[model samples]
Target chain A: MKKLMNDPERIVSSFLDGLVAANGTLIQRLEGTDVIVRRSSPPQKVGLVSGGGSGHEPAHAGYVGKGMLDAAVAGEVFTSPGADQFFAAIQAADQGEGVLLLIKNYNGDVMNGEMAQEMAEAEGIKTEMVIINDDVAVNDPDQRRGIAGTVLVQKITGALAETGASLQDAKRIAEKTVSRVRSMSVALTPCTLPAVAQPSFDLAEDEMEVGIGIHGERGMDRREVASSEKTAQLLLESVLKEIPSAAPLALLINGMGSTPLMEQHVFANDVIKQLDRDIQHTYVGDYMTSLDMAGVSLTLLAVDDELSSYLQAPVHTVQWTQC
Target chain B: MKKLMNDPERIVSSFLDGLVAANGTLIQRLEGTDVIVRRSSPPQKVGLVSGGGSGHEPAHAGYVGKGMLDAAVAGEVFTSPGADQFFAAIQAADQGEGVLLLIKNYNGDVMNGEMAQEMAEAEGIKTEMVIINDDVAVNDPDQRRGIAGTVLVQKITGALAETGASLQDAKRIAEKTVSRVRSMSVALTPCTLPAVAQPSFDLAEDEMEVGIGIHGERGMDRREVASSEKTAQLLLESVLKEIPSAAPLALLINGMGSTPLMEQHVFANDVIKQLDRDIQHTYVGDYMTSLDMAGVSLTLLAVDDELSSYLQAPVHTVQWTQC
Candidate 1:
């Protein structure tokens, strides 16, 4: 597992520096921290903040811009950020209005985000938090891990917050989005940490792990590698069965780190063909990723008028843009 | 190699179908061919057309939209499309004005593109062609392979054509861009074709291939894998030495296929630090890729004020957007 990095200890800082260097026009780093905020002047709206581990390159930072997250905190690779860093992000992102934290339902992330929210509230700043646990792969709904569906939550809530919505309204919408979306992934190969040369897990060339987690957690089942159509059917069926309604779907075909766009799009074609209902909006790319893991995830968001409009709304993020 | 595809024979068609399925709002497939054209009604401007082997996702097709390419013809994986397909692309793209073909300087592509231009001219559809040989790694300038720098050529010329430039002017600017840009790549691992079980090329755990082609063609040199900073210096030095002028530069840090964005950005950070000239533009991502190859390429386009404006102009393509 060779990496194009200088020092394993400096991977996160180098990544932040590189992102700002390439996109300084749209985003900037918070002076002495791993926090990235939009370069534009803070708008008088509810600030949206989301963050977690660092290996998912575009997940938390690539989305920091005008129409998405106001600020994103970064942790070390596959590790959660400390409470102080999240607090710093909240302070940087907040305008006159309050702040809303969109947290993925990982244990470390939730704990740190809660601690940061408490710190912000102590300083007389209004704050709210929404936990996203949309991964249907886990049978226990409360224990489900948030995966690619968190991106949809960010986009929809970010659009609402940009419209000067109140913190309560933003939290409500974020919660609704969390409840409405679900994701499931399949991994053909596991990822290795930048500091380590060994893969997180092992799989034979002819096998695949279904319902894999973004952090390289072992999936619920392993099976013989299937064709694109069958893989789509397997993931889509699991995702569809967990959705609460038959509303028009907003589909996201996300590439786990190393899968090519060619494979992602090919799988998306199969998923669209198998679904019977209307797909209001379609997003296909590496929106969220694990570190060089060769796999793909399918996220289905049941959208009505409001969610559909927000999903289609223009965004100026680096990874996921709509014009 | 385990691929997320149904059959090797159907890979190209499936890829095209998947692309159209996801981006139907912006692009559509030509009725009976593999050419992809914009979904919007044709504008009465010079049509810009480009194409090549199909393995490079988002290169020729991901660029077809309002401010980029008008049409893109697709070939099989790493195989050239026939002249007839290029002719169909020209016919579909041409409105009342003529069409300009952007050909990368591979022997098969040049021959096919030239034959297609002749065929279109015979049918009274006036056409012009520009060949891009920007890879400076090859010593013979005429024999140099066109690589990631072709994307910049497409972009600059596409923006010019969208402004209703005459076919002659579009061709002139396309040729100018071809002359101004240069590229070099480093591959840490080689990719495997969908139909074959063997890899394209092999590298020891500690080795890297420098100056590699976009296809699986071997590079000019091989060495022990170095740090991101050292890699950036090596590639930048080669690219800068060949550039003709000391004018501002537009840099593209392109991911070959499977290199993670985290690694790409880290490399971008190093490249920006080492380059001393004014970097007028910076694009970082998998713009043009070799299927599943883990590598990165650097492309530099020496830009003047005129070229910078076109480089920054808004484009609404599937893979790239500026709004």
Candidate 2:
């Protein structure tokens, strides 16, 4: 695959530099930290922090703004941010109100975010955390990995913090959202990192992998290509079964970077037809994406009044804005 | 290319069903109109409406929310929404405050949006428009096609409208933002439409097209693959020379879907190094994308106080919420 870069090793750093240059007013690099924080941070409220591997754009860092995260620690592509970076992000965003860390439930992410939280607590800044394991794809609920549903937690919890909800309350909301959401994904093709210069995995031209992870990890099942309706049904069935919802819910149809909007929309249609509930709200776009991999993921958030209202609230950021 | 769909013809309709199911509270589809509007129609304030083809996710629709657009009209994949759809969007969004149409410079988008504006005017519902022509890669300044910079115009103008700016004032702001913005894109590979079921174009393994349009249109020049830093320089040189600014600017590193965030960031880093002015804000994510095509685009908006403030203003929606 053709790529634009000086060297694979320099790719990430170069991109970070460009990002900093472009959003200098809104964000600044924490000295000695790979974290990016709002330039005017430590607002007079509780601090919120999130981070992970860097490939998921607009997720951890794109979320660092007024109504969302105060700081985002970024790691290399698909690699967890180091604990030191997370600690620095906490330090940068911390106000007297304390800090709350929003972590996805990946082994590396959970461990590193937890370590950073511990370090921040040791420094006398009270820190709390919510581990979001919202993906219902895994067989063991106890080991279910986090996926795109983590974004909903960020949105809800961030809005709560902006409205002066205490850190404890924010943590409560984050945890609540996580518990109420579930996601499943399927991959049509493997993505290649600029540095790696090879597909993450090999698939026959007619094959696809269901329940694939963001980092191109192995999934629950693999099969030949199926119709859009069938694929959508497959994903929805897996997600809905794991997090059965009787009440109104929110649905997110996310493209794994390389999937066309046409395909995503087609999948969304199938999901709606198959889902047997009142979907309160729907987000059909590339919200959480894998880089250049043709695939889609479905996230369903069982919405209560509070989560629904929060989801409807206004926010401002580069990647996503509500009115 | 592998895709998911039972019938290509049913794609748009089915996708709309799922979107409404998920975002029904904030947005509703205008029956038989192919338009999506804010749930609270006859918006309390001046209405903002923008749209084009369906492939560019989040541009025309993901933007419909509390602080931005009141409605968005969608057409078939890569096709402009019809005049009837645009008219329906206007009717749904228009209150006593009038409406403003933010249109890209594409031929079809401009014609159809203009026709709708005329129809609205005939109905005595005040209407205004700002045509965004921001692609610097297209050599002719007077006839440059609109590309991603139109997104900035939508955002800033939408924020202004939400803040109660008059339709005329909103149009002026939108026009100003459009004038101050420039964009250029490059494609490493062509996208395939599910209906067509073929690559948009044949790209050699090592080929790249610089200054490509969003709809898989050919760019100004085709060149062999270059280093990320070199590619960054080539793109920035054109944008900077065309836009010509010594002041800080808001930069967007947009993906045309298939390119991974790793590559986008690497390109962004190179862009920053080549920039001669301060970086005011940066959006490094897939704000607007072309289906599943593997490519990236760069957008620069020269920011003034008003534009920057508006850009930072709050918005609420399902796809994008910055808290």
Candidate 3:
């Protein structure tokens, strides 16, 4: 697939620069690094930091704003950032109250995030890390990868941190948020990396990849493409089986880059109709995306009063804004 | 270009139902019509309404909320909504106050909107209409089509109407807003309708359509696809030439559905770098789209003190919200 980029090597940096320029009032990029931080983080509050690969456009960076992440470190497309970059983000976000790291359950991200926490500690800053493994597609828990559910965790944890929670408190709440959320994706068409000339995977015109990874990794199963209703039912049943409780839920229908909002909504309608539960909140859009991958991911967060309130709290960011 | 829809004939209704389901707190559909209105429009305030074809996902519907549009009429995919549907929107939005229709400069939309206006008048409801022709791609004024710039006009005029401006005052400001905006688009790939087997237009692997319309219409020119920098330079130069004055600008980098946000931001960065004038606001996202066409459109709106203030006013809608 042809991309609208200049140099594939500089694509991530270019997107970050553009984002900071467009949202200069709310965010700023740390010079010489791929770390973007809130322009004015609340003083003496537990700072929130999250980072991962770059293809997820709004994932790590779009969540950096008021009432969300204090800093987001970006790596190259579909690749984790360096440990030093994560450490830089920790330093920038750390106040007197310490910092909390929300790491996705990818091997590189986990290793680098832990290394950054250590680096921050060596510099006399307190830090805590929470690993999110919300994808229920994989049968083995250890093999699960974090996906769109990370956004829900960010929203709740960021709001908790903004309320001046201690690092321990924020860490506990973030861990809870992570545990209660589950996500799975379906890819109708594979995404191509800017530097790559071919798509990540191939599918027949009538085929789809189910339980797909956000970084264009192949899914657990493949099937002939079905109607939106059937697709939503398949994803929802898989997600519901892994959910921990029958509590009120928050539904997120996330578009995989190239999926139209029209299709997302159609899929969402089918999902909502098939589900029989107390759904408190419904968000549909491209929250966490795989670059130009045409598909949708369903995220279900079992919510109680605490999680529900935080989800509804006012957040002003570039991609996800509620005011 | 396969879609995640059940029936092409029911796609519009399904999308509207899904939208209302997701954003029930903010907006609702008028019983049997494809008209979405704000949940509770302030009484005695001049109403703001906008609508067009259904493919522009957030354009007319996403703008319906507290400080923007009171109602949005949706037609089929790329087809104009019926005059009666628009009249339903007008009657529902009019809360003992006059209603203002913001019509895009399309032949069918203009005709249907005018018919709706007459129907409302016959029913003893006051109404006014403003036609927006912001696309500078067409050389002939009469042939221009309204595009993404319609979003800016909706924002400013919606805020104006909320301030209890008379219908005449609202129409005046709406016209002024329309006159100050200019937009141009470039498409890398064409979109296919859900029921159609072929794309609207075909492009060579390395070619792009310039000056493209939102309805998958053929562009005025075609050229080999270039780097993001070159593409932005071409679109920005065309837009700047048609801009009326040196007033500070509000820039909009709109993604034609299916264009990844990464590419959109990369394009936005290039556009911002090439512009030499003062820009007060920059919005980069899929504000308006042409189904799943892969492209980007740049909109430049000259803003004065009055326009700037209204543009920045707080609005609460499904697609756009500011506290």
lDDT by residue (tens digit), candidate 3, B230-308: 9999999899998866689999999999999999999999999989889999999999999999999999999999999
What fraction of the real A-B contacts shows up in model 3?
0.76
Q: In DockQ terms, which candidate is top?
A: 1
Model 3 over residues A1-323: C-alpha lDDT tens digits? 77899999999999999999899999999999999999997779888999999999888899999889999999999999999999999999999789999998999999999998899999999999999898888878888899999999999999888888899999999999988899999999999999989999899999999999998887989999999999999999899988866688999999999999999999998998888898899999999999999999999999999999999888988988887
TM per prediction: 0.99, 0.84, 0.99
DockQ of each: 0.86, 0.48, 0.85
TM-score of chain A of 1: 0.98
**Residue A110 error, candidate 1, Å:** 0.7
Worst 10 residues of 2 chain A by lDDT: A314-323
Please provide, for model 2 over A126-230, each residue's C-alpha lDDT reduced to its tens digit, 9 standing for 90 to 100: 899888887776888778878889888888887888887788898889988988899998998888776776899999988999988888999988999898778
For all candidates in order, state the fraction of native interface contacts they contain.
0.82, 0.75, 0.76
- Per-residue alpha-carbon lDDT of model 2 for B1-323, expressed as tens digits? 77766766656666566566656677788888778788763336998888888777666777788778888888888888899889988888888788888888888988998899899989988988888888887777667877778777877887788777787899889888987998989888888775886889888988988888888888888889888778888888888876655767998888786676656777888787777777777777666778777777888888989999988787665555554
Candidate 1 — which residues are off by over 4 angstroms? none
> TM-score order of candidates, best first?
3, 1, 2
Q: Is candidate 1 or candidate 3 better by lDDT?
A: 3
lDDT of 1 by residue, A1-323 (tens): 78899999999999999999999898999998999999884458789999998898788999998779999999999899999999999998889698999988899999999999899989978899999998888999889998999999999999888888999999999999998999999999999999998999999999999999999998999999999999999998899997766688999999998999889888999998998889888888888899999989999999989998888788998787777
